[model samples]
Target: MRIAILAHEQFPDGAKTALGVLRYADDEVVAVLDRDRSGHRVTDFVSDVQDAPIVAGMGDLEDDVDALLIGIAPIGGGFEESWREDVRTALERGCDVVSGLHYFLSEDEEFVELAAENGCELRDVRRPPDDLSVSEGVAADVDAEVILTVGTDCSVGKMTATMKLARDARAAGYDAEVIPTGQTGIMIEGWGIPVDRVVSDFTAGAVEEMILECGDDHDYLFVEGQGSIVHPAYSGVTCGILHGAMPDRLVLCHDAGRQAIGGYESFSLPSIPTYVDLYERLAEPVRDAPVVAGALNTAGLAEPAAREAVDEFAASLDAPATDVIRFGTDEVLETLLSSNPNR
Candidate 1:
């Protein structure tokens, strides 16, 4: 599909969902709607992803788009009032409106009417399935080795690391699959139950369901993780995933030099060692998942600095580590394979 991402003021950095789509989605991105960076090209900011024009609004798009994707998954995942005009414009132009936000665009009367009138779809990727229940501890019984990406904090490259590791594992001749747990992952894989959107009681069940479905087919299941276990607002979701997936191993994800939780500056993050202890301890009762490796996000650092950060991070965790984007996932994948000798 020909797509235009609506990212508003958050372009390259704050728009994690947008960057994921740009890097991994099979759909063609025609334009990026970011008023703050209008007239700039995506290559000007990030050169690796598919290059596209950054336009001020939908009216600036010179080419027709099949869909307009909501690209910013903010702290609360709320839809901004300022973006309503662009959503309306996209629907009026007969383009499908896709959103990954907690705010359901399909539930909005105005958007619903506009989409129906224009014969367009309002696809809410975060919507949970109707028949979800509490997890039954079934994920632990899966035949595959499940490696979950747990994070020091939210948006610290858990999803990205999970995707990269799964890809590299496949390249190395292992049957691997990415079990997406968020909207961006769902969009890329075309299947997953967004645990964050499910009722708190059913969050673990949602994750368990996916693990059971794919476990028999793949030798390795790289479950895309959500939220940090230390994050005050999102910790519940994090715990739910940990208990539900019952993973055999865990890969700790963290942004290099992040001393405090993103957006919650008043609360400082625990040390790397503390985070490792916390995740392992939390998963110990339900499962024996250890933090086997580290996936550090060194995007803010230069190549030399990124490498240094990765080394330092690895030393702290006492495990193999790498900037999966800059360096390949060889070290991490090798560690994963080595950890599961019997598999």
Candidate 2:
């Protein structure tokens, strides 16, 4: 089968590589589209697909291919329209379409109806991998009453939230350990949680091992996945880690500030977005999965703002107090977790 992947040039290397895996398994690739010209070339990875051919425009692929993998590279306003037209054209050509990039705007009723009428299968490729068939609880959840996963990167709140939950568990008189996913030090003692250094390697097996080690003997484990794997500068291998560990509950750390209000701007939230507005956005791909609310490092050294935000966000979502905590100071962490029984 001849498959064509239409993408923007700025697409993240990890996703491109993952798509390449699909390409490697499938037949020839007809085209690879992108708006930008320079970066780590996709051809290196998709050698066989490249051997077939690549065209600069999605329109160029028309009627020449059987399947069209629409790689939705995050594009802004005008480009988004152009890309949608390209997608529609591919569908009209009777091609099967799959996409992980965010392109479905609520207002795109015309495009949506057209796509439905055309019988194109638009699938989100970046959605969680569902075929693992791995057993949950096989590697015991950490036996410590609670475990905290921390980091020094953009989404430290994810780590802090996990730690606070652990501290809260201990303040309520349960044993807990707050370990840094990186080298960040534990600010306070007591609370009964120990901080450990995260492993440097971020491959699938390595991440799985880290989770197994951290969660060993602990009842509740807080694994932090900070930053978007799709972003270039903020490269932390978060997606691979998430895929490898598959934490009991994923607390996706997001920015809750002005930018992320409605999430109409971007399909996948930015790595360090201000806040999470669309709950359905986070829930859908993970199979309508449960997610703990996580925020970025906004309330550092401040008493009320971070705590208030987390509380309000949780209240709105009715998220479990036990599962959600402010990614802030030790005092705040203690206060948040102390109220929950599931620590």
Candidate 3:
């Protein structure tokens, strides 16, 4: 697939969709469609995208592009009316549209007619599957080491840490697979059921099914977690992720500077140790999943301060810790190796 990402006005937030696609999808990302950023490189905004021209309109898209990826995750994950013209143009050009939003472009008659008229496809990535049911909690039956990324709060690098550790484990000669649980992860990995989009009653089962499919023979199943278990509104999805993965080892993901949960004001964050205990208690029914390491997100802090924060965080937990994004996952992988360095 030759993809042209429709990022529009939302550079980083919209380009976030492109981030996963550029990393995991087997596609030639020809350009990113953000009008104001035209002529700039995608690397200018997302340093990891290698390089793709930021184009202003469909006229600027390369002639051979096969698809237009709606490459932004907005606040509510809803379809923005403002993106209509861009998507319409893409479809009119006979490029299939792939959307990860909660809104289904396939269900919209305009998009449906456009795709049909142009022989283009409309893919809705967040649509729940038809057969999902309550979780049987059968993931523990697998022989693999199920390791999950649990976070102190949402958007605290849970998915990134999970993917990072999986990459490290593979490089170290272990067979590890990261099981994605969210829309972005699904987009990256190509087959996960979006547990959050499923009916609340079936969310856990959706996750459990994903685990059983991927957890069979891998040395480690790095389950990408969703919302915080302590988050008031999003706790249900978090609980589903926790119970479905049924992990035997856990990695706690948090940011260096998040003193409290981002949106909620009433609660101050407990100490890292306390938060670790909280996760342990929830996972106790499945296994005594120790918080094997702390994965810190020290993205904006100075390099020296980030390193200091990593050292201090490890000291606080008396366990392995690293800014997995800024730094590498060697320390965290070493901690896992100490217990079982599988080949």
Candidate 4:
């Protein structure tokens, strides 16, 4: 399908969902709706992904789009009021409106009416399943080797690392699958329970259900991680995923040179060694998961600095490390394969 991403002011960095769709999705991205960077091309900011025009709004779109994807996943997953008009315009143009936010566009009366009138579809990707229950602690019993991506903080490349590793593993002739836990992953994979959207009591259960479904079929399950364990606001979801996954190996993800939580700047992040210790200790009771590797986000850093950061991060974690996007996933994937006894 051809599409346009509505990211408003949060393009590139803040619109992670947009980047993920641009880099990995099968659909063609015709344009990006970001008022702040109106006339700039996506190639100007990010060279690796699909190139598309950056329009100011839906009306500015020069090409016909099959869908309008809400690409910014904010802290609360709230919908922006300023975006309502653009969404309305898309619906009026008979285009599907896809959103990953906690706020459901399908439930909104105005959007709902507009969709019906234009015969358009409104997809809320973050909607949780109705049968979700508490975790049964059976995630560890699966036959597959589970390697989950845990993060030092939010948006540190957990989803990116998980997807990259899964892709490379499959390309290497291994039966691997990515068990997505977020909206962006769900959008890319076409199926997954958004763990963060699930009720707090059922978050672990939600993750467990997916693992149980895919575990026996694939040799490896690359479970995408969520919020940082140290994040005050999002730690619950992070812990739920960790305990629910009960993974055999963990890949700690972090943004290079990030000293504090992304949004909460007052609370500084713990040292890399401290984070490793915390994750291992926390996973001990559920399952003895060790930090097998590291995925560092080195965006905006020069080549030399990025390499230096990767070396330092690897030294601190005492494991293989690399920027999966800039470099390949070879180092981390090799480490995972070597560490897995079944392989």
Candidate 5:
């Protein structure tokens, strides 16, 4: 689909949803609507966000775009009333609208009528099905090698690492699927449980079901992880997802140059060896998955510094490590593809 990322009022701030669409969406992204970034190239700021021109609104949109993706994930996941006009304009232009926010446009009478009249569709990604059940731990028994992207902290690039690995693996002829474990992934991929939305008791179960379902068809399942196992506030869901996925290989995601756990000043992020060992210890009874690689988020770092960080991280692990976005996930992907699971 030819697409325009619609994050007009809120880009370059908390525009992760927009960045994700730009980074991983398979469609042709013709433009991005971010009033704050008008007259700039998206690639100038986010190297991974592609080369699309950043426009102020639909009036500046290039021709032939078929979809307008709501691309900002605000805190509390609420959709803003301010963005409605942009949505209306996209609908009038025959563009299907997809949003990752908790607000459902399909339920809005105006949006629904506009879409119906224009033969467009609205995809509210967080809309869960009524028949959902608790996870049953069935993913553990699946035939594929289950791997997950666990992070040192939230927003440290877990989903980015998972998606990059999946894209690269598919390119290398593997039937790899990154299990979208959050709302953003759900919005992008059309499947996944917002593990955070489900009741706490069912979070792991929901995660398990995603793994189990994907396990049957794919050669590898790279589960997108949530909050840190060490994060003070969001740890519960983090641990729940860990147990449910039962991965045999773990991609430890961490950002370069971060001193403390984000927003938790009292807590200092642990050393690489310490975090990796603790992750293994936590998963030992359930399964003996090793932290096979490190996916270091180097977005804030310069090229030389990022490369140096990758080398130092690789030196600390038995497996390969690299900045998946900047240098690619080749080292880690080769390690997984070449290693014999039973050996």
Candidate 6:
């Protein structure tokens, strides 16, 4: 099957390239088209057959070609006419198009119409699930726990959420401390919890070490994946941890930019958005545990536009609090952790 993979945005570039590399390695790459600035392939742009007659874009697919993988990144940035033309061209040529790009992946009216008109079957592969098991002897209780935040695109809030939740618990007069558990060290000033760089064979070992440390000081531990496991920003280590930890409560945090058109689907697997969605998509393969709460954040001081989007999401999903932690404030976080809602 001749497959034409397209990359028009940032997040998908990494994933697209990675996919191409894998396919080529496995001798399945018919051709690769990447518009983003990626340093993976030595050639600026190359075709599969070297110098044979090839189709230009999606408009010219060979008779034997069966599938076309259209990848688009950076959806919130709005769509350009050229991109619309590309989509039109791809569909007009009669190819099976699969995309996990956020913008074109949603069930939006326009995209739905486009898919129908083009006779194209759109399958979104944004969130691929994690296939790892939880570490043994880690599921004891949930109190004064340690939170692990590590990976490619580790959010400051992932660790900060620990602070906010822990603080809220403390205000309710519970014992909790926010600890930084990961292989890498972050610049968390006020989160006065201990820092332990767990050495492991891989990322999974690091997570196990963090949880083991948590067992000593805190009963319950919350570990945040650095990036999207499904998206391109995710790390193999993070997925390993998720599989190995089998955490009691899986709190999936969604960035406000998520609902945007090309949000999560734009990137490759392991991206932050894709990682979170992976948990949502693959139910049994990933984890059987129920998600305690789906946290939402604007990734900053909540601008008016961002605030509006997040508010609507929080209202819809019933998230208790949204981005409630200030940066580098141990006292504030301590207070929040002290108030345990589960208690």
Candidate of highest lDDT: 4
lDDT of 5 by residue, 76-156 (tens): 777788778888999998889988777788888999999999999998777765556766766678877788888888988
* Error of model 5, residue 290, in angstroms: 1.1
Which has the better TM-score: candidate 2, or candidate 4? 4
Model with the higher lDDT, candidate 1 or 4: 4
The weakest ten consecutive residues by lDDT in model 6 span: 183-192
* Each model's lDDT: 0.92, 0.43, 0.82, 0.92, 0.82, 0.43
The local lDDT score (0 to 100) that residue 14 gets in candidate 2 is: 23
- lDDT winner between 1 and 6, please give it: 1
Please, what is the TM-score per model? 0.95, 0.37, 0.93, 0.95, 0.91, 0.42
Model 5 has an lDDT value of 0.82
Q: Which pairs of residues collide in candidate 3?
A: 14-72
- Give per-residue lDDT, candidate 2, residue 324: 36
Kindly give the stretch of ten consecutive residues in candidate 4 with the minimal lDDT sum: 334-343
Please give the range of 10 consecutive residues that has the lowest summed lDDT in model 1.
334-343
Which clashing pairs does model 5 show? 135-205
Each model's number of backbone clashes? 0, 21, 1, 0, 1, 57
lDDT tens digits by residue: candidate 2, 167-266? 5565666555443332111112111111111232333344445456656655455554444444443434544444444443444454445343233345
Evaluated at residue 29, the lDDT of candidate 6 is 40
Off by over 4 Å in 4: none
Tell me the lDDT of candidate 4: 0.92
lDDT of 6 at 132: 24
Error of 4 at 85 (Å): 2.2
Ranking by TM-score: 4, 1, 3, 5, 6, 2
TM-score for candidate 4, residues paired by index? 0.95
TM-score winner between 1 and 5, please give it.
Answer: 1
